[model samples]
Target: MGWIKNAKAATLGEDARKAWDAGSPVFTPILNMPSSNAGLSGRVEDWEHMMAAVLAIGWRLHTWAVCSDSRGRPQAQPLFVRP
Candidate 1:
């Protein structure tokens, strides 16, 4: 089971890299929450779902954002890391 999780994480990293290179969305299913849910309960439910998905995968997430600097140079800023 541990090995299986490792393999899945490896595949996920490869797929994420490909999507990043192609400028495509990598986490489509998990990210596509309905915008109509604008209540506290709805938000909590959504958070629970996302947390479950992340924990089940057994992989930490490092978030990155693409932005431009003062000189208009494109750069990636890493934020909100979990280990």
Candidate 2:
């Protein structure tokens, strides 16, 4: 089970890197919530949701850095690694 999660995380990381290198937005499916609940929630916090999702899947936030996108907009990119 742990190995499977690790493999998934590794794949996701690779895909994210490729997208980032191509100056594309990295959309993490795990962080997405149902659109219908958007109004009810009002606002969604990123870090909180990320932490919850990663922890639930037996992973941890190894590190993060501020990276620039294609539009030169700064974004905090988190790297998740297996614990």
At residue 25, what lDDT does model 1 achieve? 34
lDDT of 2 at 39: 33
What TM-score does structure 2 among the candidates reach?
0.41
Off by over 4 Å in 1: 29-83
| Weakest 10 consecutive residues of candidate 1 by summed lDDT | 25-34
* Global lDDT of model 1: 0.41
lDDT of every model, 2 decimals: 0.41, 0.49
lDDT (Cα, tens digit) per residue for candidate 1, span 1-83: 44544554455455444545565433322232223433223243433344344434433445645465555544334332233
In model 1, state the lDDT of residue 23.
Answer: 52
| Candidate 2 minimal-lDDT segment of 10 residues | 25-34
| Residue 21 in candidate 2, Cα distance off native in Å | 25
How well does each candidate superpose onto the true structure, as a TM-score? 0.32, 0.41
Looking at candidate 2, what is the lDDT of residue 4?
44
